[model samples]
Target: MVGERKQEKDVKREKVRGAQDKGRKTERKGQKSKRTECADFTDKPRIFPAEVIAGKPVDISCTFDTTCNGTAPVLTWDTPTDVSGSISNTVTQHGVTLTYTSVLTLTASLKHHGQTLTCRVRYPSVSSERTLILTVQYAPQDLSMTSLDMINASLINIIEGNSTVIICSVKSFPASNLTWRHLNVPMNRTSSNNELWLVIPHVTSRDTGDYECVAENEHGAVEGSITITVEHAPRNLSMTSLDMINASWINIIEGNSTVIICSVESFPVSNLTWRHLNVTMNRTRSNNELWLVIPHVTSRDTGDYECVAENEHGAVEGSITITVELIICCVESFPASNLTWRHLNVSMNRTCSSNELWLVIPHVTSRDTGDYVCVAENEHGAVEGSITIIVEHTPQNLSMTSIDMINASWINIIEGNPTVIICSVKSFPVSNLMWQHLNVPMNRTSSNNELWLVIPHVTSRDTGDYECVAENEHGAVEGSITITVEHAPRNLSMTFLDMINSSSVNIIEGNSAVIICSVASFPASNLTWRHLNVTMNRTSSNNELWLVIPHVTSSDTGDYECAAENDHGAVEWSITITVECRDSSEWTAGLLTAGIMLNLFVAGILTFVYVRKSKTATEERVAEISDIELSPSPLTVKHQGKQNMLLTDPRNTTREGETSAPQGSL
Candidate 1:
């Protein structure tokens, strides 16, 4: 009994030995997916034959393959609870494949059959894993079955044209027969130690449905089922218009209703969602399809958008990207390519037919006139065409003023000083600019939006209202500004006693003289009369300065100046007034004529030569004269006027009570 126990211990030690203790074996080739005709192999881990009898020590090995290189791999094994195991790793190289194997040696029991043994290997480049369902073989009591969940095929998902492996293993010993059927039909299968592997190298929709495994012994028979549901990842993800036209990108107009419909096809419907950048959306949805609608699209809605659809089994992504544009359109391109419209090199919203593009300007104002360009392009290159549209409308915002003046309706320009009159206007189709003086057209140079009327030297002729006229084919507008030209006093002269200019005045003693001054200037020059260069009273309306010297005498002989002035400048004219004395010979001649007139004196001289005295109050008018009587002694004459009275010898002047001139020697 001691030797038998020792033999059992040796067997258990043998089961726990490394995989290299036996021999190196070539690694099995992995399966590959087909793109065209070439299939690429996949590097993954594998474990097999998941059944063992009770009280039996078994050596379980999991193998993984990778491209043969100098770098080695590391392996680990995870076993069921309370099932201690001896784990070891071995590496074998055969041609281009390097196989890494991990072995788990343990005693089998019914309590651990339903558990799992997982083998994990990490290479210098990658990592892989494989799980084995450890089913313990029980003696046939009533031929009851145990579960092999590694092949628990309620529903299996296999991509079309791809390969998959199905496992059918038994937990009972001494099986008489083992077979696999697809709808009760026999199929090619691989078997080892009451275990089978059904490999469908290429799957199709017809390969779907139940595939059953039957295990029969002398006592009873047992059966298990695997349901294969072949499917493919989502394909042909796209966006289409209402007419079902496929599109990669879409352009929509601003402030208009628009929609983007995304669709995809797969064996199973996928969950669809809309996205912009990285954020997911809770948008309009209908079973793997969605519509993004903008009832009143605005400028902020222009951007890039995406529609994504995905599913389980093998998750796949189908994406459709959309772009929104502003008010612009373009059409009439061949080779079926994308088109774009730009205003000053900017994209805008537009309407299209057969992708017909146009730039729409609804309720166009004067500001909407400019040049636009449209581009038709593909992957090769791009060609661009341009259009210039002018929106004809009435001239607007018309205003007129001088450059030196700020929004003033009137400006004062000094005479002989330079100034400018400018008018501002806005219109389409190049508005015609014009300037006018007092409703009469004046020649001017102007651009479409502004006009200038230059007055190099301002004069009275440029003092009227200047009108600025801006007109287009649609309508006309006008603005007016008054130019008040200021000038110095000019053309100063006198008009009294036919004295058109400044000159001396000869007046006998006791006689009156008159002088007047006038001038012409803007702002109605103020005229003043000055005595001996001294300023007199000033008046605006009265441009006339009267120089009336009543009862002129020698003392009054001086320069009397007349001045005209305004805010611009002033001018003056002077008159030299002189008073002369009468000769005595004239008095002797008058005495001899008085003797002849003595006979007529009784009829007319008595009435003319009476003693009379009078005073005058009118300052600008001449004083009236009174008759004087002849006297034996020299007599003096007195007169009343605005000036002081002067006295002279009686022989040289007329005296009261004198019928004739005083008799005096010359």
Candidate 2:
């Protein structure tokens, strides 16, 4: 308002000066013919308002007082933004004194600040001008917020212990005072020029939130905000204990509530959880702390309890143990006495503060199911109390065994014999043992830990793998062993000439005869052919024996026996070989051969004496017939079989086109 009044006073003074100069000039001119002279400013031309507000309208005027021969000076304006409007000119004549005034209504902007604004007054012979630098006043605008070192970081996100610099800048007439605010609350800061800077060094998780930048002046205040997020990994995990009890071991009474607390320090408010035996539990959390409550404790609820805190960075956890102990109290006697808790026969040696004794068992399995005894002894007498703890578990040490002398992999059973096989197992709460052969369940007689499978007479069909499956309420297990049935030779028979299987056979005199004996047995039973109850030949190959008699004479005809034997027993099957005797033809031919042999016999005696004398013929005759027992003593010789047989000395008598059966010892 003061600037507007000063501009009005300057305009009035210029008009008065113009009136004084024009009056003298007008008097001089009136005395002559009324002619106008070139106008000159009696008062200097002036432009009002050196400073202006941006984006607002203000009138700028330039007034000139001229020695008037009654002509007004023309005025024009030059401005920074190239603004053009009508410039009003007023010319006043007071007795030939004239004053010229020009006004331009202008709206300045920030671009016109510090630039030149000019108003020029012109006459035909004289010209004058007024120029001033424009100062623009405006509220803070075109506001921007950024980090000084980071690119496009209006909002900052960095790891913990890192640094970031934030800056707030704007355009204003009198440079704005920049301030920083957090969560809409202004923060005190040092004075700055044009721009506000917030230096956050060594940022922690507490530094994460909204931070706003405000740039203000007398005109107006403008603000911009940025978010700073500081990331810190989860760390410093702890499981706190409320009482003086150990953190890892907490013994609580039954039907009492047990609370476990876990705490951690982190950013972004870590998620907290509780777990028991790897299963999640209901938990409540507040800030960086987590808690879990377990009510009505029992032996089933005894296990490890864990607390976990998790976030985007990482996760941390802590664990504690809780148990409900078995208490055995009271050692009352005539006087005060001490008591001891023992597991079976061994002393537990765990101390307690009072008379009550506690037995704590952790992670009980099948092996831990047994009786626990507590004995209290003093100088007078000894008393005892016992408690039994049973844990249910699966079968252990399951196996199948046989009473027979056998190896680990297999059990051998002979035919027509009784064998006992047993399946046993060890487990808690009594386990049922079952027997299976090739997946077929066997009806077995079960006693305590053993199940018996009795085979009254083992046969070839019983040779297979057997399974023993033990089961309880907890689980089941199975074991297996192979059983093989053994038998002696059976179904012995003889085939005559390899073409007949019978017990008896007939043959013609001077005809060839052949017989084969075969039997079936495990471990390959030995097969033998006998004649007249005398051992003939035996072969162990394929459990078969061959008897070859090339020429069937009456001496060769007898009962031929085929026998098969193994370690178990022996069996015999006989074939009667009947040879037909020759009739009168044999008698006539024998008489003719005897008459001819009589003539040669006398001559052969002389020739035989000559050959025999050279080699002791008397001794050679005795040796040749020594094996043929003429007395028929039938010398008994015990062999590898159960029967005794006749013996003959070994000799090889080979005849052309005839093959003899195996002779003994040759």
TM-score per candidate = 0.30, 0.38
lDDT by residue (tens digit), candidate 2, 1-666: 444465567678866875675577667774765545764444457776745777778877776654446455677887765654456777676443355778888787777677777778777787777666667798889888776444245657778888887877788877888888986677755453678777877888888888877788887888877788787877888876542147576665444456677889877668888888778885544367887777666778877888888777778888888765444456666554456777668887643333445555433344444566766665677777776555444455555567763554457778778888877766544667778887788864333557888888889778767767666544555666667666877878666532334666776666566566767666567888877678888876346666777556888867778889888778888888877766767856755654565446545544654664455323212111111111111111111111221111112121222212312220
Native-vs-model 2 lDDT? 0.64
User: Ten consecutive residues with minimal summed lDDT in candidate 2?
Assistant: 623-632
- After best superposition, candidate 2 residue 293: deviation in angstroms? 6.5
Task: Write model 1 residue lDDT over 321-361, tens digit each, in one string.
Answer: 43333334444555544666676667864333234564555
Q: Mark the regions of model 2 whose C-alpha exceeds 4 Å error after superposition.
A: 1-45, 55-57, 68-71, 78-88, 92-97, 106-133, 148-154, 181-192, 209-212, 236-251, 254-261, 268-297, 300-316, 325-666
**Model 1 Cα displacement at 572 (Å)?**
1.8
The worst-scoring run of ten residues by lDDT in candidate 1 lies at 611-620
* Model 1 misplaced regions, further than 4 Å: 1-390, 404-407, 438-447, 498-502, 506-514, 523-527, 533-536, 540-543, 548-554, 566-568, 579-666
**Candidate 2 lDDT score at position 375:** 66
